[model samples]
Target: MLHLRVVCPQGRTADVTGVLRDEPGVAHLVVHPGVAVHPAGDLVEADVARECADDLLGRLADLGIDHDGGITLEQLDTVLSDRADAAEEAAPGDGADAVVWDELINRTGEESRLSLSFLTFLTIACLLAAIGAVTDSPVTVVGAMVLGPEFGPMAAVAVGLVLRRRDLVTRGAVALAAGFPLAMLVTALATLLFDAAGWLTADALDALDQVDFIYEVGPFSLLVALLAGAAGMLSLTSAKSSVLVGVFISVTTVPAAAFASVAAIEGRWSEAGQSVLQLGVNVVGVVVAAALVLLLARSRSRRRGADRALSDG
Candidate 1:
């Protein structure tokens, strides 16, 4: 379920309330007239079933309330009312399966920012992965994979493509374009420094039998990337953090980037090129798979909403 807060102007109050009243997926609808001073309107609040939230928000958007007033949507962690249960039951689909576009876009938009923290996390994750590559440490490689923040921007790219929002697409693309190269460059420099300081060695790189998959673009790499990308997007929409972590661990993006930088620094040109190719393949697979997943989910949800409307009519 989600909690909705709306500021409705005096002139459009009746129309807004009428829409709210007609929505069976709304629960505990409350309207306090002349309560909003800043927007100079009434304050209306309600709990909307998650499955119906996108549709309800779309209807409200069409009413021009967003221009004259405002709408706030929030996740409800706990809703004890029987009305909440009834609202979910009456809704077209399950809340757990709902794709709240507004929430998703907002989340991915913020996460995709090329902020300092984003760069720092990616850099640290790659450094960790580089170390793992030299030591043949699978655990360290997994940690780097989990620590990498690239998934959010990748998801933003897919979301932008599906929605045809150029701003989102541009933001995500810029982040990826600037972020990976910068991180890899830094890691490559660091690799040389560490090698000079006797921290990393050529013998260790040669003895790497466990984590060689980092540089190898095997037959299953793209397939796993496709599966992980779809699962990652679903986890994002469904609020499944545990599943999302698994998705993060399942992809070889961070490992490939880290190994590419390390291998290049050590003059392993062929391995470096292959690692770069693996990175590109994984990224392309994820973006394409996730975009397809979002497209299907959006179509199915809209179709169900339309079917429910026909039944109601």
Candidate 2:
């Protein structure tokens, strides 16, 4: 279930309440009139079934509540009310399978921003991967994968494409476009320093047979990317943050970036080309797969909504 706190203008409180009351998936509705001070209106609270929240929010938006006031949503970790259970039962599909498009779009939008923290994590992850590549350390590579923040923007771009949100798509793409090059550039410089310090030798780079997958683009690489993309979308829609950790570790995104940095630093142009290709293939595959997954999920949710509307009539 999701908890919604809405602020409504004085003139629109009754209409907002009406929308909540009419929604079968909404329960425990409360209205406190003349309580909102900033916008000067009423405060409304309700619990909504996760599966039906997107539609309910759309209805609220249609009522101009979003523009006239504000709507805030939070996922309830635990709901003890019988009414909450009834609301979930009243809605179509399992709560865990719900898309909650509004929530999804908002969450991904924030994650995809080109913020300082995002760049820091990306740069550190790339640097770690570069270290792993030159040292032939699988543990370091895995650690870098665990720390990489690339998936968020990719997922955001995919979801944005499905939702037709140009801002999200542009922000996500810009983050990726700018973030990767900056991270790689930093990693390349770091690699040069490591080489000068005698920590990373040409022999070490050439002898990394175990880490060769980092630079090799193959069919299995795309296959892994496809799986990662599907799993990533599922984790997002289902609100399973833990599942994303596995997705992060399984994909070849950071490793490719790391390999490219080292190869370029060592003047291995062919190997650098291959590594970049690997990075591009993985990113494109994940984006395409995630978009398809979100598209299908939204389509199914719409169809279910249509059927319910007909049955209600």
Candidate 3:
């Protein structure tokens, strides 16, 4: 359920109220006249079902209530009508709300910075990829994928584009562009150290060359990234965020990045190019898919407002 608080001009209260009263999925209407000081108008409060929120908002906009005031929807998790029902049933509005855009971007930025804090995770991802290449272990490759943190910025870029948020786009691009090169440089240094310690040899480098998956870039990989990106955005928008953890592992962005780093470390230019191409494919696919998702979400919101207006009429 969604609770909406609407403020409108004094003369517009009746029209807004009438609209809200007729809208489907709305109940428990309360009108407080001449309560708003900012717009100096009346306030209409009501509880609406989740499915009807968008439509209700649209109707309200059509009624011109949004011009005089604002509408806010608070999700209610539980509903207890009878006062006595409260003893057995916990009241609604108890659960923490979904994370919004500000929180998501802030968290992503923090994670990106943390990932760059030490070269350890980057190095480990690259080492794992290298080992995966030598041993041809899909499991090890997946582990490298999970360990890499390249998706945050890629997602950020998509979010930025859809929202027209230049700052987010800039930050996201910087993080992604810097992240791969930084990882590659660190992995290269690590390779040198390992060689000096006799932990890496020409045979290991040759084994990396034999790995075939890195060079295989096609439409299939792009499709996977697109799907993964959509899933990722859905996970972000949903109340259940635990699903995103799995999404983080499902996308090959990080693994490809790790591969690129490993290839650079081994001085395999052709493999490095393949890895870079893979990274590009995944990034582009996710960004395009995510942008589409956000666009659709915004369009739904607009349609919901239109429905609200029709209800008012």
**lDDT, model 1, position 41:** 93
Write out the backbone clash pairs for model 2.
Answer: none
lDDT of 3 by residue, 1-313 (tens): 5568998888888888887766545677899987899978888888765445545566778887767687777756786654223321322222222223443555555554534453467567766775676566777877887777666677778778877888778877887777677776766676678778887665665654334665568778888889888887776655455766677666766566666666666677777788789878888998898778777766765664577459658
Off by over 4 Å in 2: none
For model 2, residues 197-308, the per-residue Cα lDDT tens digits are 8898666777888788898888999999999999999999999989999999988988898788888878888899999999999999999999999989988997988998
Model 3 Cα RMSD, 1 decimal: 7.2
Residue-by-residue lDDT tens digits, candidate 1, 157-193? 9999999988888888898888899899999999989
TM-score of candidate 3 against the unseen true structure: 0.66
Location of the lowest summed lDDT over 10 successive residues in candidate 1: 199-208
Model 3 stretches astray by more than 4 angstroms: 1-124, 205-211
Worst 10 residues of 3 by lDDT: 87-96
Worst 10 residues of 2 by lDDT: 201-210
Candidate 2 vs candidate 3: the lDDT winner is 2
Off by over 4 Å in 1: none
TM-score of each: 0.96, 0.97, 0.66
Model 3 global lDDT (CA atoms, 0 to 1): 0.68
Provide the clash count, candidate 3: 10
